[model samples]
Target: MALLDRLRTREATVGIIGLGYVGLPLAVAAAKAGYSVIGFDVDASKVERLYARESYIEAVSPDDLAQTDHLCAWTVDFEQIATCDVVVICVPTPLNQHREPDLSFVEDTARQIAAHVTPETLVVLESTTWPGTTEEVLKPILAQSGHALGRDIFVGFSPEREDPGNATYRTQTIPKIIAGDGEAAQALMEAFYGAVVETVVTVPTPTVAEAVKITENIFRSVNIALVNELKLIYDEMGIDVWEVIDGAATKPFGYMPFYPGPGLGGHCIPIDPFYLTWRARKFDVPTRFIELAGEINTNMPAHIVHRTREVLDRAQGRGLNGAKLLLVGVAYKKNVSDMRESPAMRLMQLFEEAGAEVSFIDPHVPQIPQMREYGIFEGRAALDPGRISDAGFDAVVIATDHDAVDYAALLELGCPIIDTRNAMAKRGLPMDLVTKA
Candidate 1:
């Protein structure tokens, strides 16, 4: 069957499972591309919000929702997905306590799909997983339906190319990397995605597609960690690492700009790389570089806390105990309101334990309820610069540097500051008031 023919007939209901950062955007794109889309999730509240056009993801605008509403519906029910022609799994693939790939979510999702597998439907795995996960782990469970691949139904893999908060490339603009088990499967999958995404790049097999996705994320993890390590070394040398990076960035060749920060956060950078490293060991290969990068990134919060302690000592006899500290931002990245795996939570707890009262200010996130790291204080509304300056804080930590923060107001506050994001120097805040780490 021709890929376009299936799409045109409306026989292909594009069902996106686990509508979070990845699935929501994909569902929006597919529905906009004229496919009937059923966005399924286990979260009932999320389903209700999507139906009302209340978006959780920053990139998925109300305009996207309005355009797709005619053909789209959100549900917590698995039975809704039974009628789908193409099922794309975009569930979370997090690591366990031992830093091993937690495949329980993926396995469970696959089992649900297996129960509904039909000869005409196409199943594609979009969650970021270890290489060989699709064929080795998913395929067998899916085949439990007594249907053979290529003959009975179609199976493929397309890693979700979701860049949350990226202004340039969105779900449809970013080219998709796809691979299928066989010729027929590849054709069906390519046509399905080509309708929504701008370009579709096909690899030889599913494993190659998996490897490509991990490599892209791991490269980011390593480079960010390298700059983070440099941030520490340069701090001890009394040189501003942020300034150094700006100067080095003038070289057009052999350099890519990566800023240092408190630590790695978000769904992809810190978590996805470890999935690859964990799987590589099964093949008797040790991913030393990837592991080292993760280690440096993970240790950054502790280092930031230590720097804050030093600043407290320099200021007064006050330890972090009862010292008023303001965390500038809580989101993992600037301009986005996602706090998953954010290091700011760790820093907040560290300061509170040392007897410091911590409050956060981010335009993106007004109030952060006490999370796992700290459970005592309820978050306040947007930070008032006038009140904060007058409040006599012992020190300020710029954990997440949101663009909305008034840089000049912070510099004029006349309080000692420990900057992990290099935002103070970048905004040309007074050198005397700023301390780097």
Candidate 2:
């Protein structure tokens, strides 16, 4: 049967790569939509959890995972790609040391697919990257299979719009932005994605879809940088930036609220915007606003560290050196165990560099995992919030605001409190002892 016909009838064997956050939820969603799903990951532990019916991502419920286990299969083997009628790549595109687009993961996955992909199969790249990556990079690698695109095979690009902690949208609910290399690939892309998501928005080509994703992140990065700068200016003038934002947000049409934080976090906001910044360098185009936004956000953790030291010295008559500090949360955001590009790691390093000892407590993230920038803290476990010692602790910093934390207890410790998220103010707590950083 033709790939499009098989896809429409829910007879397609969907293969999803890199089953971390995006791929796992997509795998489960495909299975729930009555399609056979094969989730591929290099992490053996993830495969083991799949067999055990355990879900590592919050977007995928454990009960839903257990129910989908009958139709969904997970493995580390790439050889099974031949069995799939539709293959979707959902890998990471992190930045390199010099902060350029690291397309290594996408290139490696494309090579793997090229080795085992069969005729009449549809391949979609869901990883965020440079605009031309789908046609300019992936298509050439896929052509190595000796199958012509829009003839013997089909390929496309669909940027992932995954909001990890969002309560409103799921894989099935969010609108899917899809594009293909050509007309034949477009039909197949529509067949597969239209079956899985509530809405499928098809664009002219992969470049348009990729650009849409980049523009979205760029909007966020620039706005966040604006607010972070405002926070600094307002702090100097003794005006509450949060109150100003709240008042501005009351005007219905003109203003959309973007909150300032200790720093930028999550996979998309901190990293994806730079993909454009790096690509623009080739054309000699200057992205001054975006670059300034990146600089402001990047320096926020350092600013926070300096502010903490100043607040502590004023309140305790001592400095950061030789002080014991506790961090309220370590995850990227509230109520989620995602810490990709979180600012807490940078804060820890800065505090330690200033001769202060730092300990973190996150209800969601139990232990720090091995990250590229902060691997030295791999085995460190989160300190129990309830059992915190008041003897040596000089101050507590609220980096992330999870509801599970007992903020009142931190107040009881009789130390300076730096509220970066304004988590305390949101809860109607007194701001007397809390210093808004």
Candidate 3:
């Protein structure tokens, strides 16, 4: 009741760890809702940028950061978490080289929070992971603080549904799903998140909350893989996938359109589904759909490469082995700077391996930053009409269809193009110059 009173009266200080895409928006929303927010991160540069009211994420603007400056403080010190009344862990749960769940970030953040967690302090994890993670992995680590759960301290799991660059739904509008270890914890968390978001869904257990997020992403992964497979089949049957999808969408009763792309990209769709597959192995359950979806999605980049070679050979009687190509839009999705698990990286590597010189142009990303697995492409080519006219490339691959691109200009160049995203079709470009891959 004390915690609930503090949260209601706007006297509670909210602490959010890992000030990236998910955490930063949450911190801002909490601050805007009249709570003092402390954003914690290990990166010194990101912390420094936050203090200066600079936002690196596309969803959070610099104006939003400046407005929250009075109520928000960005820090790198873990001890400052002790001053917070509630702490939320929004860390990344990336997969390892073996495509298994890697909970190192979440585990490390829980250990840090345990060191400073006090009696009556509410702690919630917003990182997406497999079921039983909250109970099996985090609870034991947090118990080291010696404060009994639901009696002295409270804990919950609330999966983040942050969609970057989404104009329709902001952090406050998206319905949050929350589950707690006990009734006390559930009540406190529901009250806390309810203050910021428009709607709150309370599940029975923490594992169910974790499974909800995984299920949402798995549905997308499998559906996207289905569309990609259909795209290949329809292409072989001399049919346009975009036209077929449009006609099917007109039915409107039992259909939701999921477009096919070069491959799966972004932090969530490409990685989160596999966490379930890894956990299912322990329970002796076979996740055939998940494994098959992963296989199809993983092979998309190679398929795009093969289509590019065929397009080049059919158009100009030249092979991709010695040709020069330009890749348009290197980011994972449209109108965002995030490049995690982007298919463009794989396409670039495939082009280079086949002895072709590749250059990229992305309006959102002027220069490609350093990535964990992908090598950095040093020079960024200009996307202007003059440059496209001057640089004689064998073909152009529309990997990501950002709105800022000049689709008409690319078509006017009269060059062979592999339109993996159907941007050319959307722009009413002629089929003669554009090959729908």
Candidate 4:
């Protein structure tokens, strides 16, 4: 189809699978661009919520529903997508028990699409995955309908660039990188997404687009590990690592600062790089840097636990058991409630195993659900200084530096604090009472 055909007809119905942080916003964007959109998800509750104009995702706006105005609807039925002009999949690609890429969600989506796929409909995989997944894994399954690609049906890959809770960027502003199996497929994808997004760049092939996404995340993982490693080194010399980082970042040309914390968290930064490394192994290529970065990032939570143990040992040789520990935040990042693969949960589990009673407090997240490890501990219901001061916690661990939290008031609580995020330094707390890791 010509670009003009899409612009004039407006018959381009967009079907988005997985009504999540990525899919919901993208569907809203497409609907705002004058295309009818249908969103499908396995979770019926999420589909029901979208119909009621209730957004569980932080990136979507309340005005988005009003602006779209009956242009979009969500469904759990897979058959409804058969009428769509374009389809996009944006599900989570989480790690399994052994830390391997779990592609079951992707496989399930492909099987569903295969049943409803028809000629001339464009299918785009927006979920982050290993290179060649679009052409190798998804294509074979989707072709089960006996439709040939580039002629009978079209397929492409476009990785989602979603920054949840970011004030400056949104789905419409972020540039999209897309590629397809052939020229016709590329044109269809570009036309489909270009109407919703401001800028769309076409790469050589779908594999290149996949690699671009992985490289962007791997760069972040590697730099974060570098800073976390340096924090430990600088701490031994009694030099404030946060101060040193701020000083070094003053140089305009050479430095891009990545801060240190208890450990890496969030769904993408901690897991996306491993998808590439796992696939690279089949090609007989060892990604040493990726492996080393993963090693450093994964070890950070345990290192923080070890440092906490040392701090307690110095106080009175009191083990983690029988110690009251307060984790400052449960969310992976500041101000966002996404807890998928959060390191704070891992730290809590490790602390509980060592006999410490762990609890957390976050204004955004009023409750932290109990896992099998940490049985049942309610988050401190209030951030009042009096409440914190009266609480009998032996130590406090700063995990997330949410703007709503008053670190000054927390310091007034008088409990010794383990400043994992350097939040105490940002609040100008005295070094006598704060220990940074």
User: 1-437, model 2: which lDDT tens digit per residue?
Assistant: 47778999999999999997889889988998899999999999999987987888898888988889889989999999999999999999999998999999999999999999999999999999988998789999999989887787788999999999899998899999999888988988888898899999999999999999999999999999999999999999999999999999999898899999989998898998899988888899999999999999999999999999999889888899999999989988999999899999889989999999999999999999878779888879998777786445899999999999999888888888999999999999877889999
TM-scores vs. true structure, each candidate: 0.95, 0.99, 0.98, 0.94
The lDDT of each candidate is 0.85, 0.91, 0.90, 0.84
Per-residue lDDT value at 69 in model 2: 87
Of 3 and 4, which scores higher on lDDT?
3
The Cα error of candidate 4 at residue 389, in Å, is: 3.4
Off by over 4 Å in 2: 389-391
lDDT of 3: 0.90
Model 2 weakest 10-residue run by lDDT: 384-393
Identify the superior model by TM-score, candidate 1 or candidate 2: 2
Error of 4 at 350 (Å): 0.6
Model 3, residue 235: C-alpha shift (Å): 0.7
Model 2, position 48: C-alpha lDDT score: 95
- Give each model's clash number: 4, 0, 0, 1
Which window of ten consecutive residues has the lowest lDDT sum in model 1?
A: 369-378
Best by lDDT: 2
lDDT of 2 at 42: 90
TM-score of 1: 0.95
Could you give me the TM-score of model 4 versus the true structure? 0.94
The RMSD of every model to the true structure, in order and in angstroms, is 2.0, 0.9, 1.3, 2.3
For residues 1-437, could you state the per-residue lDDT of candidate 3 as single tens digits?
89889988889999999998899999999998999999999999999998888899988889999898999999999999889889999999999999999999999999998898888899999999999999999999999988897887788999999987789999999999999889989888888998989999999999999999999999999999999999999999999988999999999699999999999988898999899999999999999999999899999999999999998888889888889898999899998988888999899998989989887778888877777677556354445545877788889999999998888888777789899999988887677888888
Whole-model alpha-carbon lDDT for candidate 1 = 0.85
